[model samples]
Target: MRIGIAGWFGSDNLGDEILLHTLVSCVRSVDESASFVVFSPNPDRVAALHRVDAERMPTLRARGAVGRQGTAQRAIRDCDILFLGPGTVFQERSPNLPWPGTLPLFARIVGMARLARTPVAPVGVGVREGGTPAGRRLLRVIGAASVAIGVRDQRSGSYFGARAQVIGDVAYALPIPDTQPAAAVEEAAGSARPTFALSMRPLAPDTEAGLLLSIGGCLDRLQADGWTGDFLPMAFGQDAQGEDDRDIYRRAFGNVLGLAGNPLNDREGTTLAGALDGWLTALAGYRLVIGTRLHAAVMAVALGVPTVAIAYERKVHDAFVDLGLGRFVVGPDVDAETLHRTATAAAGSPAEFREAAGRVARQGRIAREFVTATLKGLG
Candidate 1:
């Protein structure tokens, strides 16, 4: 059997790559004979970065409908099954980025699969807030896909109608090497020096630029409270000069707190596994996490660190709420004083925080089983 996978990939971001690897690996575990045709923005880059032996399927530039039916049609025709899995596809958080013509892309791919007698599925997918008219239209079309649909959030599951199943984020199910000792994780948290981690993406093209100013101000307050700032950029899109944001935050710390530079730029790291391993290990000492990326915050939970989620959209809020800790989430426009107060309160309960982390670890194991079983059922 052959499988075709689609979504945001080939970027330097370790989180997206890990989710892709986990979904692909789970599918293959159930059917070892299956091979993959991955639809990626840049095939050669993805191949080199992940070392994945997948057939390179082209996608359009990050603009609206530029090459919609071009490469996806071909991939759909050739595969036994095609999947549009996880990523920020359903959310238009960055106004600068173009929205995919969802109806056309889905129709063409699903039509091709129908003509070729192939099955289609949407797995580990979630639809967050869609503010624009085009965005909401795309959400409706994605909801109507006549294939197996597994949504990560309760909101996205409701959007998918009757056939949809509510599962946790796919990254929760992704495998990590057992390198870090449990005792080491506990000891680091107990050190209690008030370490804070932040992972954020740039706002959409249409978003107000001053949003960055707000974030900078919040980080500055964090510094005054004697918090050490750690920054992780999840997906480095086309922007090269974006490290300035980190610099601004680091300077806000007034030299007392140190900054660990971009984890992706580390020369020694090659594979997604290596990058994530290095990044998580480096942050093992964090006491509080202020993360924008869903998986970055999930990584903190996986490593027994308590997190404060900067909820830019629904999925961010939903993920933490489902984990039994909504108090850690705050709005995108949150003020510096609010951020400082929230972090201070969150950091005080280290013991309870550790227990919550344990729950996430257990849930992660169950999430892995869900994906494995779903793949077997598909086969």
Candidate 2:
């Protein structure tokens, strides 16, 4: 079987990579002979990491110009099925970066797939704040074209009405490593102070400053309670124009331990599985995670660690709400005192939080079942 997967992938974003990994795994479990071709911004990187054939997704410059004869369009035309998403690909809510053409690009991709008579399935996806006009139209087309549409949250399902199935995020079903590095385990066990992991991203200047200040205050309070901090960068952008999470972390907490720096020197001959294992190992050590990035919190929760989600975007809150961990989510307008208190409270209720996360992980298996059943029908 030949399948084509498309999403906001290959951007050095750990979360998206993890989602891709999980989606591929789920599909392979049901169809061992399945072959995949991916559409990504960084095709070479996707090919290197996921061991799949890849083509660059149609960019804004190529918008409305992709014909049936175009390389990417031809590949999709030949594929038996197309899988679109596990990310907030439909959202136009980014304040710093505008994605005016993204939805239209997706519409064209799906339109091309439909023209070729290939089945399209949108899985583990979400819509942010009802999205733009193009995005809403894309959703309508997806509903009309797809064999099944599986949204990651309730709010996202509302966009498609009866067409959408409420499947949990694919990341929750990702396979966890049985063991971490011995040294990592020992360090975490030996540390006298409680460890915390932090994930931050780019935002509006004023909002960014406020978030940093709030985080700094939280760190101060955590330090007073004898907790140490580790800044995790889930995504590192290419070139100067893109936003880098590492830079954001450095600006917020200067010179702190950066887990994203690959402190364990884990990149030597690294594969996707190895990188994911290394990240999971590092995250397993944290007593708490304060995350602005959705996947950072997802990974933390999957590892059974308590997390405080900073909901700069609706998807963040939506994911937490799906996990039944909504109490841990705070908005950008949240004050430092509220953030600190929430973090402290979440940290204190570790058992309950972990249990809730585990339940969500269990629920995520429904996504795999949905895929399997859909594929079986296709066969």
Candidate 3:
């Protein structure tokens, strides 16, 4: 079986790359005869970063911004099945460069599949409010896909009718490294001072300069509450590509906190793998997580740490809601007191929070089944 995956496959970001890794692995596990074709913007970059050989595997150039129209059409014509939105395909964007706006390409591919009578399925994608008429229409077109499936919470589910299936985030099924993470966790947990895991992406449309000030005030409030704030960089591809998370954070918090002994300095330029290790390590030690990165908060939950999700978009809220962690998410514009209050609430019942995380982890089992069954059904 030949399956074509259309999403953020070859990005340097660990979180986005892991979606492809997990999905491809899951497909192979279910059917050894299955093969995959990944359409990546930077196939060479993906090859170097993830050590994935693009030529050996079924690959075609279908990068959104770089214009891979011919290759994408050809691949769609050849593949037996098409998968869209495994990663944050619905949310990934840059100022003046909204590559994801090429979402219509997926719809067009699905349309081509329909013309050819090939099956299509969308897995683990999110839905959010759109800003423009074209964006909304494009969303409806994607949502109305005949064989599309999604994993957003019930709130996001409202965007699509019967066609969209509501499951859990596929990130939950992300393969744990064979090497045990317990030692790293234990070491960080043994830290003498109160530590925090602060994962922020580059300054995006949702995150402004004021975010740092708000966070700085939050740090002072935490200190008053008997905690020390240590910023952890969950710098994935955005930061790896030289996007500044702390500079944005500094714009908000630098004046308030004085920038003395900031921990982010140690983690500024690390690769995604290194950052992942650091995230796990800090989770073992931090009193709580206060950050904007959705996947970072998910990592904290996976590690059984108390995490306060700061929702810059609806997907973040949906993630927290899916994990039954509605109380853990705060608005982007939340005040310092609100941040402290929510963090305190999340940390109040650590055991219960851990229990909820375990429950969230169990959702991964369902996700695996969902993909396996969907692929088998298509085949």
Candidate 4:
């Protein structure tokens, strides 16, 4: 069977890449001989990393050229099933204005599947409010076109009523390295200073300065308390649009002591699994993680690391709450002092945090089973 998987893959976003890797891995486990053609912004990178046939995602104008039978159209036409999303690709928001949002591309993909008489399924997708009318209309079309829609959270599932199953994030299915040391126990055996890692992404211009100040102040307090800080950038490269976590990290924490010249930035590789493995391995060393990226927080918890989530969006908030770590989340309105206090308290009880995270990780396996069952059903 041939599967045409499409979403935000091969964009140098570690989280999306990890989810794609996990999704492909899970599907392969169920059907070893299944062939895949993925749609991605960086098709060469995706092909190199995932070892799958990949075509560049069709641009808005390219959709108009569908009559000419482009590479993307051909891939979709040949597939038996079209799989869409394991990320926040269903949202109404678009980074660029005066342009069609992501929904149009989604609608176009489903349209291609419909024309080819192929089943389209969305796995571990996320949905949010405040979408444009065009976006909402496209989402409805997508919902009706899908054979089965699996959402990553309850909020996303509500959009499709009973058809959308809440399957949690697919990244949970990613295999954790067995060799990583115990969370807090191993830290005690290390040096006197406990390490703290901070992960941040770009925010709106109006709120960017304030958030940076708050994060810097929080990091300062942690440093004063004898904690060494490291900035972990989940998304790399300019192709990631405005969600450049590395650039944001450099702008916010570049000069901060113990954070400057950290080697984590140099650890990523061409392969998605290798990059994720390196990230998780490095994150396991931190006693506390303050993360704005949802996948970064999820990955940290998967490795049994204590994480304090800074919820810039509902997905981040919902994921942490589902994991039973709601107490560690601070909203966008949170002040610098509150962030410091929360991080300090969260860092103090490392054992409790680790235990809670471990419990959530155990529950996340349900998502994997759901994926396997869904794929088998498709067959």
Candidate 5:
């Protein structure tokens, strides 16, 4: 069987890359002999990293649409189905980045699938309110073309009508690694100072600094109580889009936190496998997670570390609530007092967080079944 998978790939976002990894892994388990062709912005990187044939995805602008049609059609025509998303590819500028899903590639997915007469399967995709009429229309138009649709959270399901199933985040389907994480804030056993991991993005410009300061102040107070904090970088080259998570950390909390290095940006460049190992290890070492990145918070809970989330986006807020951690997510405004309060509660409730992780695993099992069954049905 041949499948064509597409999303915001090779964009240096590890969270998005994890989705690609888990997506391909899930599809392989469903059909071991299945071959894949991916369309990405960085075709070579995606091809090498995922070990699949990849074509540079076409630009969304009208000027170059025709020149790129052949590549899109070739990839689509060869596949039985075109898989789109497991990312926040359908959100509006309200949460920032005004494009209609991955630089308005939603239109491209529909156009190519239609031209090739291939079924489009949009699995574990996220959706949010669109500020503009055109943005709202693009979502409806693309969603109408999908053969089977799966959204990542409840709020997104509301946008796609009854056919959309809340299949959970595809990243949750990733297998738990057995490797011991790298030495982080203190990976040693029985450490006196407990440490927390933090991740942030260049969220809404108006409120980003305030949110950072609030969280930073909370961390300072916690450190005074013999607690420690570490900055974990989830994306490496997103600096072009001003979305690099590390840049904000350096600018906002550099005084309080230390740069823990990402594998991609390390002085000695590392392979994707090595980077993921170090990333997971650093996460596993933390006593708690206090961050805005949904995946980081999700992973912390998955690793049995209690996490307090700052819900900068609706998707993050909704996902945590669905996992029985609603009380653990703070506001976009994120006052220090509220963050400290939630962090305290989360740190004290390891068992509760473990149970939350179990709930995620349960959802992940269903999502995997959904992927396998969907692929089998297509075949």
Candidate 6:
């Protein structure tokens, strides 16, 4: 069997790479003989790293009419089925980015797959809240094209209604090493002050001042409590400079530790690029984690780190709920005093948090099963 996957992969975003890697690993667990042909933005990098045949994802302008042929058409023809999985699939807006949206791009993907007579199954997809009228219609077309659909959370299901099964994040199901590096764990415990991991992304201009002030204030309170933090960037843009999250996080904390990286995009640490297990292992070493990115929370929970999710988007909120860490989530507008209290409460509740995270990680097995079942039907 051959599976063709298309997503925002190889874009210098570790979170998306983690999602892609986990999905590929899970599929192979069910069918060792299966091969993959991926459609990626950076096809050469993906092909080399993933050991798969890859082609550039279709350009957004190519309309998939009855007789036209292109890269997407040829790849779709070769695969038994096409999958739109992982990452924030249906987001219509970005905080500061200038791109229009994904609706039209996905419409073309499903359209090309439809023309090629290959089934398009959307599994482990995230649906962002709020959509334009035309975005809504394009989504219906994509849903109608799918053989089966699995959404990342209950809130994501609202967009697709009954057709979208609530599949937990497949990335959460990604396995981590059994133990963290002793040095990492020792640093967290052996240091004079406890240290937490912190992650954030770009916010709208209106929200930045208030959010930064509160975040700064919260870190100040943690300082009083003898705690320190590190800023970890989940994404490093392909443009050589780091992503906005790196900058935002820099402004949020005065004395936070941050690793310097080159154009290599290994924002976490050296030897961490494209390695989910390694990243999770480093995350496990932290006494606590507070992050605005959904996967930052996802990765943290999977490692059973005490976490506070600052929900910059609804998907982050929904994911924490799915992880059984609902109470740890806060909106971006959260006040410093409340955030300080929440952080202390989380730090105090490690055992309970670990228990909840383990339960949810166990449940993540269903994601593997769902994909296996989807493939079984296709076979």
Ranking by TM-score: 2, 5, 4, 6, 1, 3
For candidate 2, which ten residues in a row score worst on lDDT?
Answer: 260-269
Model 3: what TM-score? 0.77
- The CA root-mean-square deviation of candidate 1, after full C-alpha superposition on the true structure, stands at 4.4
Would you list the C-alpha lDDT of every candidate in the order shown?
0.64, 0.79, 0.62, 0.77, 0.78, 0.75
For model 3, residues 213-325, the per-residue Cα lDDT tens digits are 56667777777766655555443343235445555445454443322222223333433333444445545555577768777788667766788988887778878876778
Superposition error at 136 for model 2 (Å): 2.2
Residue pairs whose backbone atoms clash in candidate 4: none
Ten-residue region with minimum lDDT total, candidate 3: 256-265
- Following a full C-alpha superposition, what root-mean-square deviation does model 6 have from the true structure? 3.6
Q: Any idea how many clashes model 3 has?
A: 4
Model 2, stretches more than 4 Å misplaced? Answer: 60-69, 96-99, 179-189, 239-242, 261-269
What TM-score number comes out for model 1?
A: 0.80
Supply candidate 5's per-residue lDDT for 343: 89
Model 4, span 1-379: residue lDDT tens: 7888888887667788788888888888888998999987778777877788998777766545555347777788888788898898776555443345577777877887888788998999987656766666677678888888888988888776678888899988888875455444455666677777888888888677788888888887888888877787777653656866767866667777344222224333445555556556767777788989888788888777778999988889998888888899998768899999998877776676667667656656777787777777875
- RMSD of each candidate? 4.4, 2.9, 5.3, 2.9, 2.8, 3.6
TM-scores of the models, in the order given: 0.80, 0.91, 0.77, 0.90, 0.91, 0.89
User: In model 1, which runs have C-alpha deviations exceeding 4 angstroms?
Assistant: 53-74, 91-94, 98-103, 131-145, 176-194, 204-225, 238-263, 266-269, 362-367
Compare candidates 2 and 6 on TM-score and give the better one. Answer: 2
The reply for model 3, stretches above 4 Å from the true place, is: 51-67, 91-100, 115-117, 131-145, 176-190, 204-207, 224-229, 236-285
**lDDT by residue for model 5 (1-379), tens:** 8888887787777788888888988998988998998877777777666678887677756467776877678878989888888787666564435544463666777787888899998889987655467766666777788888888987777676678888999988887766443234364565667877788877767788788778777887788878877887777664247668878877887888877656556424344654676677668777888878788888877777889888877778888888999889988797888788888998888889879978888988978988988887874
The residue ranges of model 5 lying beyond 4 angstroms of the native Cα positions read: 60-65, 94-96, 99-104, 131-138, 179-190, 266-271
Model 1 residue pairs with clashes: 94-204, 95-204, 95-205, 96-204, 96-205
Best by lDDT: 2
